[model samples]
Target: MSFFYNYSANNQGLEIEGVQGQSVFSVAKGKVVYIGDTFKNYGKLIIIKHANNYLSMYGFNKNIFIKLNDQVSENQKISTIGCLDNNLSKLYFEIRFKGNPINLLKLFPNIKLKQH
Candidate 1:
């Protein structure tokens, strides 16, 4: 039962800002599929493959706890928000089903997101 405040996302995923040192957790148990820091705009990025043909991406992370092909459990801490432009740290998260983007809230009904 995790929650986020003051966040926004478009059709692709949720954009959470001002979460500097907060811990980013794995939404569901899965195996690390990809981990890289080549996204010019997103900084370090991590991708995980879960059951039911689902995938989760965590972008712009400051630190990563697991490596590629590692197994992770639901709610496991994977990374922390990374510093962005102007020294502001934020997190970019996405959930996809069969390679198609899906609303995280709709995908995981228990996690709550409230914008202020």
Candidate 2:
């Protein structure tokens, strides 16, 4: 998991470094709300809306397996990790509640985010 930074800093997500083409999974069961790279600096991004006004985001994907409005299950493979302009393979993951970013590490204390 990445270090914490205030929302205004634009560091609202966790960067999970991994090998190129590694699988990326949905954090929970949700409906795909957005699927595109239009968001600046978030390459090939996918957003899912979960219950109780929660949202999950997966970014920097090499390939996306699901489409917009797709109902995805927990742990479902959504995409493959992609490289940024610097050529580093990573997945930018985030969770939000009511439009505010939440600390993932605090929420899943025992979960491992890094991939080798």
Candidate 3:
């Protein structure tokens, strides 16, 4: 599917605008298979395995509320937005099929944030 950010700032992974304590919701039904902080640029991260062998990756979260193997529904709250090492709040989202990253924006045209 498509990914949507709640803000109008730059869409770059490092430049995205994420508000602290804001809930990060699941875009679709899936099973959480990974949840933890990354050692590098990703910060906190979570991975959800969806139907048809699709996986959604949510990174730069302040906290991960769900655990591995947890079933999550569409729009379900999963985590809170976090920041980089520089302390800039941002969420890095991705959709993958099998193991490859897919451009999710193509799937949700209506929800895309406009460029300023």
In order of appearance, the predictions have TM-scores of 0.78, 0.84, 0.76
lDDT of each: 0.81, 0.84, 0.73
Candidate 1 Cα lDDT to native: 0.81
Q: Residue 72 of model 2: what lDDT?
A: 99
The model with the greatest lDDT is: 2
- lDDT tens per residue, model 1, 1-116: 22453234434676677567689999899999999978665689999999999999888898899999999999999988888877967787888889888866766676666554
Flag regions of model 2 displaced more than 4 Å.
1-8, 109-116
* Model 3: lDDT to the true structure: 0.73
Answer with 1 or 3, whichever has the higher lDDT. Answer: 1
Tens-digit lDDT track of model 2 for 2-106 = 333224465467777788989999989999999998986779999999999999988889989999999999999999999888998878788899998887778
Model 1 misplacement above 4 A: 1-11, 105-116
Clashes in candidate 1: how many? 0
Compose the digit string of candidate 3's lDDT tens values, residues 1-116.
22344342322221246677778999899999888765455677888999999888888888787889999999999999876667657777877788866644566556546342
Highest TM-score model number = 2
